[model samples]
Target: MLVRIVKMSFEPSKIEEFLANFETVKTKIRSFEGCNFLELYRDQNNTNIFFTYSYWNAEEDLENYRHSELFKSVWSKTKPLFNAKPEAWSVDKIASLK
Candidate 1:
């Protein structure tokens, strides 16, 4: 499995708009082919900061999603809300407790 994490920071005032937009597309994104898991997280100290954690079948599956129209559409709508550039990582599991 491939683990993908994205950290995003939105302008404090734009957070609500971003959340609303995310809610509208979250299901489609979670159900996309090769997506095994999808979730959202927010920083305890910074309500405007968020993270997306997801699992994919492989890197290719991730690439497919990145290139899809869904990504383009969603990203375009979400980009303007950012207070800072987003960061992302794709990692392999090196160890697990359970």
Candidate 2:
């Protein structure tokens, strides 16, 4: 499995717009091929900061989704709301407790 984490910092004033946009696209993302899971999290101290935690069957699967029109449309709407560049990490599990 491939684990992907994306941290996004949004303009505070645009947080609501981001949230609404997320609501519209979250399902499409979750249903994408090879997607095993998807979730959203917010920073405790900074409401404008958020992270997306997702799992994919492989890097290629993730790449396919990233290149899809679904991603293009969602990102185009979401990118303008960012206050800073987004950070993304793609990792493989090393260890985990049951």
Using Cα atoms with residue i matched to residue i, what is each candidate's TM-score against the true structure? Answer: 0.96, 0.96
> What is the Cα-based TM-score of model 2?
0.96
Where does model 2 exceed 4 Å of error?
Answer: none
Those runs of model 1 whose alpha carbons end farther than 4 Å from true positions after fitting are none
Residue range 1-98, candidate 2, lDDT tens digits: 99999999999999999999999889999999999999999999998999999999999999999999999999999999999999999999899899
Structure candidate 2, residue pairs in collision: none
Query: What tens-digit string does per-residue lDDT give for candidate 1 at 1-98?
Result: 99999999999999999999999999999999999999999999998999999999999999999999999999999999999999999999899796
The alpha-carbon deviation from the true structure for residue 22 of candidate 2, after best TM-score superposition, in angstroms, is 0.6
The lDDT of each candidate is 0.96, 0.97
Query: Relative to the unseen true structure, what is the C-alpha lDDT of residue 98 in candidate 1, on a scale of 0 to 100?
Result: 65
Estimate the overall C-alpha local distance difference test score of candidate 2.
0.97
